[model samples]
Target: MATERPGASDGGATPQEGARTAQQIAGELRSRIDRGVYRVGQLLPTQRELGADFGVSRDSIQRAMRDLQTEGWIESRQGSGSRVIRARRIHTPKARAGQPAPISLGPLISEAFEAEEVSLDACCLTAEALTDHVGVQADRVARGEVNPRSISLRLLLPSTEPKPAFPAAADDPGDTRPYERWAAMVEFHTGRLRDRLLALQRGKFVSDVDVKVRRAPVTPTHKLYLFNGSSALHGLYVVETRAMPLSDGTEVEALDILGLQSTLFHFEKTAFERARLIHNSLVQKVK
Candidate 1:
């Protein structure tokens, strides 16, 4: 977007306020991009239109656009306003020699349990992804492939008491069938995962297996897995348009987000700025 800065005589905002405005704008726009409001390859709205819509000056819009570009969400050209480079994947960990190839969620879970005392802290829309992988770890323990003396897992899932913001009917706000289905899935998977972990204790496979779950007040825009409080794997939830089947066999097109299919970017405690920020935030949230 070709945004022009407002002059001093225009009674424009101060530099600090302008920076904060730019951050807010950038955040909102990032969410929209993840939600598929602006699909890949589509050009963003012009600076003048964005300024009018957000009620900000052209300078703020420019700053926000620059942020998007730096994050690899969009690309700006001389003649082209700004095109979405990708709908997902703002960052990825760099590969290093003598290190094993990056692993998926299931293997990551198994590896985490190799320690004597295993602890996992996760925050996501649902516990489905964690549940699936924990099952894999349980299978290994059951088969004597690996065993840890203690297993402790804390899961933060969106509350069921309140209506969820996602998996809602695309056109009908009052229809809650999608939300109900999602909640049922969460309950089943979490219960099964917990059963497997607890069985290890019951069968004397391990001394302690403590599984705790709590409801998060907000819907998750990203999924985080903090392993042993030192390593982190983070991924975004990208919006998807697909048809879903109901219990009665009726199908409906729904707007939803996928967690497992998205790439899980790996990070160490001190690797990069974004990873470090997420790591610290999750550590504080769990505390």
Candidate 2:
């Protein structure tokens, strides 16, 4: 019988196997962070929890966490668990001439505008992000860079009349000011987005620009963007306990969702059939 080596599964040592496993685990965790399954500034699950979830040994989990930390994706403390420091770049399908890489929302929207006709449907806590990116695209159009003849945008925001949910004061249940602030924010940003899109038509940059806004009764748990029926980008709203300062200098602990910091995951229609169906259904429902 052959004697077993120190790092071997059988007789031969396989140090590379452990390294490869660590790499694979690191990649998966990185993907999750990029896709918002793990969010920035959020503490990651404990090593034991992660080890169980990944069906790996504690050493493997430690190696993967070390890899993430070395790559600047996370930070670990002695007593505290690992926390997400930053998200990795979203890999786009390809690159285009004279256009930047599609790593974030702005570039993705600009890429969408390269089409002859553009359709953007988004449902989120606020239209602030969409509005910001549209502004960037508007500048591109203004420069005669992208000339989409028709642009159709539909926005679905939570109804403010009836307080939906979340953003409530954690300690003081009677205080509803945080909810009110969120509602006002949604309304303001939605209005701004509408005005910006309408301006595109007014400027004669685009022959047809249709902007529609609707109120959803349900509080949004996730933000969804379906781009021209081809691809979908989704991000979950993570409710966190944080303190919010009111206009009158009153600070209260409340449950809140960080919008812009949420990592967005991209999916193509061909790859995720169920996601495609859900996206289509949502579009129709909001229409």
lDDT (10s digit) by residue, model 2, range 43-155: 89999898677765667779999988766567687887887755544234444686433335554576788999999999988776677667656766875868999999988
> lDDT of each prediction vs. the true structure?
0.77, 0.76
RMSD of each: 17.0, 14.2
Task: Score every model by TM-score.
Answer: 0.59, 0.59
**Model 1 misplacement above 4 A:** 1-103, 270-287
For residues 64-109, could you state the per-residue lDDT of candidate 1 as single tens digits? 9998876666767777588665555434455478743343454456
Residue pairs with clashing backbones, model 2: none
lDDT of 2: 0.76
